[model samples]
Target: MLPAIVLSVTIARPWREVYEAFWRPEAFPRWASGLSDMALRPDGDSWVGEGPDGAIRVFFTGHNDLGVMDHRVIPDGGAPVHVPLRIIANGEGAEVQLTLFRQPDMDDEMFARDRRWVRKDLATLKALAERG
Candidate 1:
């Protein structure tokens, strides 16, 4: 199994409200900087966008009652990376969590960098969600 880490941010909003506001594939680029340079456009069952390395295709989990917001990202000519994200109730607020998997080709440094990236993205999400 691959090494993994789960990072999270607490948002001052209802879990359902937060999920409803940003669970779609198009909303990802607003916080997930690593996924898109600008915006993502729908392409069949997935979305296409320009990533740092080039173009990427992303497949997002369908909307449901559960707070699941998982997605699979396929970089141009590269393997797919699965990102597991969720928003769960934390009292009257919500906790947004993301799991980062250390890929087979990743070194300690690479994994650490990705961890930082995720952390920053989560912070951005929190700010966006909490904004008035």
Candidate 2:
């Protein structure tokens, strides 16, 4: 297992609406900067996206009621990266948290880059969620 880095942002929106924004695979590219495109597989259990590295497969493992948005990303010919995301109610808005694990082989530079990327993506998500 690798060390996990937790990042969070508070969005001025209900938990349900915030969660719904992330539930749709088609909306990934809009907020997830790393994903250039996303398309659902025929099986419907997973979705494929074009990542910085190449084609990447994603499998979401969470529930709507619990506001858990955890998912696993498998890059082509690479190990799977587990991402734990959650939406928590805060007063009338919601707080979004994402846990990113640093791969065993990742160096400081790469890990820092990943952290920045996640922060940017979270900002985008916040902007979108708050727009409504």
Candidate 3:
């Protein structure tokens, strides 16, 4: 079985503002801890970046921040996973659903390492948006 964390983050800001920041790959380096650098190219509209292995950039579509990503890790003979984000408009602000799906198969030591990374990342994202 895969262990994953799905969390909801509410930002006390306009939904559009929050969504745009999320869609821009460049904004990731600021909020995403594991990502080194990220950008979107004009040609294929493809996004590129370097992060913890098993992650890929996909142009996000739909009524979201507007980006796509295939950040999934599939075990032997398994299928790819998916992560989804949805922004909801609150009274004068917004909340976000960070849909996470992963097969938690890493060893205990590595699991702890990944958890730390993830925790810091969510915190950073919250701070970045709220502070802006």
Candidate 4:
């Protein structure tokens, strides 16, 4: 099993509203900098976008009543990396959680950097959700 870390942020918004606000493929680039460098365009059942290393194809969970926002990212000529994300109720607000998995080839420093990137992105998402 790969090493993993779950990072989360609490946003001052309803869970369902928060899920609806950012569940679309086009909405990802607004905050998930670690995932896509720009807007993702629909391509068949997935979305394609320019990622940090190069091009990437992402498949997101279909819209549902549950707050599941899981996605799989496949870099150019690379294996798919599953990213599990969820938005659940936390009192009157929402708690967003994202799981970051440390790839088998990743070193400590690389994993740390990815962790920090996810934290920053989550913070950005929190700010956007609160203000929207």
Error of 2 at 117 (Å): 0.3
User: Candidate 1, which segments miss by more than 4 Å at Cα?
Assistant: none
TM-score of 2: 0.90
Question: What are the TM-scores, per candidate, against the unseen true structure?
Answer: 0.97, 0.90, 0.64, 0.98
Q: Which 10 consecutive residues of model 4 have the lowest summed lDDT?
A: 34-43
Enumerate residue pairs that collide in model 4: none
List candidate 2 stretches off by more than 4 Å: 38-44
For lDDT, candidate 2 versus 3, the one ahead is: 2
The lDDT values for all models are: 0.94, 0.83, 0.59, 0.94
RMSD of each: 0.7, 1.7, 4.5, 0.7
Query: Candidate 2 residues 8-127, lDDT tens each?
Result: 999999998888778666666778877555544523688886788898888876456878888788888999888888889999999999998999889999999999999999999999
True-vs-predicted CA distance for residue 27, candidate 3, Å: 1.7
Residue pairs in candidate 1 whose N, alpha carbon or C atoms collide under 3 angstroms: none
Q: Give the clash count for each candidate.
A: 0, 0, 8, 0
TM-score of 4: 0.98
Candidate 2 has its poorest 10 consecutive residues by lDDT at 35-44
Candidate 3 at residue 15, lDDT?
A: 76
